[model samples]
Target: MRKVLWIILGCTIASIGVLILRHSHVVTGGTAGLSLSLSYALPLSFAVIFFLINIPFYLFSFFQMGWKFTATTIGSVSLLSLLTSLDHLLPSFTLPSLMGAVTGGLIAGLGLSILFMNGASLGGANILALFAQRKFGWDPGKVNFSFDFLVVLSSMYSIGFSKGIFSVMSIAITGFVISYFKQKIALHNQPTPASVTQPLDNAISK
Candidate 1:
């Protein structure tokens, strides 16, 4: 219950970040970035592109991460798609390119961190990142950054070079946040030597 709410909140925050980037005519990386780039060329909405692009990744998630995680990711992605589409209904505004880049990246980083902690994701490269981590112990951040570079590079054609550069900055900030927090969480989950010994000592005393 609590976890579900956290996931929803995370998705909402990340969607808002994407909305900000869209309004500023900037892009990020990952599957969402690919969807944004496509939306520029096609008449489709970002929501439609995002949802469709993620469909194939669900199979990877299900096979590698299990049904529960896959279902949760589906829910998160769907919610983000709906929210991003509905952003059209919100009052229109704009931000300076640099500000938009930094703000969007920070907000997205925080949101994605929350989703990851809750065992949900926005799919696409996220699925691959997790799979690589599980199978080969590759850092998810590095995997995501590699995919992000390709997606953002492709966006240069749609969004132009200047915006693409900003997009890179945004994703770099986001990836750093994800990596830093993920590592910290991993360390926190490890049993300290004192903690291990304390339990054994307690058992011996009993």
Candidate 2:
């Protein structure tokens, strides 16, 4: 129950960041950014594009991470899509480029870290990152960053060089934040060392 709420919260936070970037005409990395880029050129909306792009990754998540993870990811992605789709209801304003990148990237990164902590993801590169982290001990954040960088770079033709550069910085900040969270989660789950003579000490006390 608590976990579900946390996932919802994460989704909301991520949606807000997406909204920020969208209005700023900036995009982050991953399929989220990819969808955003596509939305700029296509007549479709970001929500629709994002959900569609993630469909294939759901299969990847199910096969690599398991049904439970895949289910949670689907839900999270849906919730985020729904939330961001509501952008039409709000007053519109664009933030300065650097401000939007830094702010949106950080918020989205923290939200994503929470989701990853709870075994959920936004799919696409996120699924790959988590799978590699669990299966091969790769750093999920770095792997994620690499994937994001490529996707964002590819979108440069649409978003232009200046926005693409800012997008890179945003994803870099996001990746660093995610790496920090992964390290902290790793340390938190490490077993504490027991005294070597604890059995003898217990026997003496008894």
Residues 10-119, model 2: lDDT tens digits = 89998888777777777678997788778988999987998799888998888877898899998998898789889999987878989988888899888888788767
User: In lDDT terms, which candidate is top?
Assistant: 2
- Lowest summed lDDT across 10 adjacent residues in model 1 is found at 197-206
Question: Which residue pairs clash within candidate 2?
Answer: none
Error of 2 at 77 (Å): 0.3
* RMSD (CA, angstroms), candidate 1: 6.3
| lDDT (Cα) of model 1 | 0.77
Per-residue CA lDDT of model 1 for 1-206, tens digit only, reads: 86788788999999888887777777778897798789988999977987788878988788878898899988888788788879868898888889888888888877887777666788998777666655676676778778988999998987789998998888887887778666532332233465443332232233
Candidate 1, residue 10: lDDT: 90
Residues forming the 10-long window of minimal summed lDDT in candidate 2:
196-205
